[model samples]
Target: MAIRFESRTVDGVPLLLAFPDSNGAPWPTVFWFHGFGVDSEVHRPELRRIAEAGFLAVGVDAAGHGRRRLPDLQERIDQPHEQALRTMTRLAAQTAAEIPGLVRALADEGIADPDRVALVGVSMGGYLVYRALLEPVALRAAVSILGSPEWPEGDSPHQHLDAFCRTALLSITGERDENVPPDGARALHRRLDEQNPRSVHRYVEIPGAPHLMDGDQWAVVMDEMPRWLERYVLRPAHTTPSE
Candidate 1:
């Protein structure tokens, strides 16, 4: 097991990285994204929990938050006033540009498997996961928490969802979530459903859960995530649209 804190310039953007310290050899890697407002601390336990389950965990604090110390356009867009679509678009572009470089660096560090990587993101991070889905890079799986695919008032993406994207996806939502209404989940699911066109995807709506149920329902997620990872992302081969 090995753990390290490192930094690298990805597409000219300075990015931060945190990896697990463990005994597993050539473990699977998790490319993690943090939720809005909160720092990396909010995601630490979740990463540790996943790492303890025998996977490499690499997390980034979305440029502005935590140690990265850059302007967080997402949070800035969420200010008291309404934000323009262009602002969100720029942030999303920055995110997409930096992610691949981050993944490459992790692979070079022996902290991630370029072929067996999975993504788990929360809230705003969840939205970014969908954005990543449209990426041409190889991704084994994605787990998005309370993120919506529907436009956030004035949000858009880098490109249209490719009909070729059959990447395994698991979008989880809390039934009682005030932050993400039921309609949003349904819409996102519907969009992905359309994007895949011929493939069947998985969407889970947990009952009696709230916006941040990490504390209350952590136990259920701990039990369920492994199977989700095993069935779709961690199998012998990465599932493709053609699979």
Candidate 2:
């Protein structure tokens, strides 16, 4: 079935909503976050796949990115690597904090099932997923592609790992990803495993892939991510009767 797409702005946050052609109320939802400098539209294919897998997929424009680019973006764009990292850290944190409210708004509008919410992000979006885990949102699962639990100087990504241990997590990265080193991804998996031995935690390393996935690598993601969410989020919900 072809997925239908719509553009919406909820309380100043620009979003792209995707769902199957069938009329389904309160569909299970996955909030997608794109990489730096990219807009939600760039992820239409992936979001469509997610919607095909029985999810109402949503993609949001990160602050100062995509259509939300600021007028003074050139100055921030020219900043040093560390400075840019700091800026991304702050933005990711702020965006993470706003997600719960956004989810609630979606639920109120009868567009999303709040109880089955999940997150999927790549690169900076992946980093935002990590940050979002720190908050008290009722996220059922999360997939972080080319993301990590490390932050710039003065930031502590570890403190939240324990908090995140309660939710199912899947962290994927390229074996040759220079932007987010493979070692860090491995270490994050190890830490999460150690913190919560009972939770479902899986780490995947795509061989010969880079920070940005090519068509084949993305195909792998398109296949695996929905399966992961189905296992941890959808399947369980299907078996459990609503209160």
Candidate 3:
């Protein structure tokens, strides 16, 4: 079946929803969040992939992006280092706060199987994945690409490692990335390993890859990400409760 697309506003949050045209009610869902300065539409390729895999894929716009873009958002982001970091963190926080509501609205509309939900985020959106995990939302798994667990202005993900134990996580980073170094993600994996040796978490660093990944680099993510979601999110949902 062909893919179906919808431009929706749920609970005042704008979302670009994609799913299979087939009658797959209550589908497993993957929410895709784009990086800073880019809107939801920028990640349409990934959304299409997730939808092709039989999951309802949603692309979310950050607070100062897409339909919510502020007139001076670009200007604010181009400010001096310290000032720009503040603006970025603020936008990330606002975006993270909307996840729960968006998830609920989709489930209520019978579009998503709330229990089989997952998230995939790039850069700024990756920060949102970590923050959303700390909230009460029951995200089954998440893939964070080129995103850091540390928030310079808010509660860093390191401060709540316990929250991560409940969900499967795959953190991918570029070894040569200076924009968002891989060190933070490395340290996060180490801590989680120490805390729960059996936890469902993995971190991958692409050799010679930079923050702005090339097609070859993204190929690695495309290969690994869907498998992670299949193992942790999709496979689990299909199994019998007794299993």
Deviation of model 1 at 46, angstroms: 0.6
Worst 10 residues of 1 by lDDT: 155-164
User: Over all chains combined, what TM-score does candidate 2 have?
Assistant: 0.92
**lDDT tens digits, residue span 49-121, model 2:** 8888889999988887767876776677578877877777777777788898898999999989888889998
Better of 1 and 2 by TM-score: 2
lDDT of 1 at 16: 43
Which prediction has more favorable lDDT, 1 or 2?
2
Best-fitting candidate, scored by TM-score: 3
Give the candidate order by descending lDDT: 3, 2, 1
lDDT of each prediction vs. the true structure? 0.63, 0.81, 0.86
Best by lDDT: 3
Model 1 residue runs over 4 Å out of place are: 1-25, 70-78, 84-93, 153-164, 191-200, 238-242
What TM-score would candidate 1 get against the native?
A: 0.77
Q: TM-score ranking from best to worst? A: 3, 2, 1
Clashing pairs in 1: 1-22, 1-23, 2-21, 2-22
Provide the lDDT at 110 for model 3.
96
Question: Ten residues in a row with the worst lDDT in model 2?
Answer: 234-243
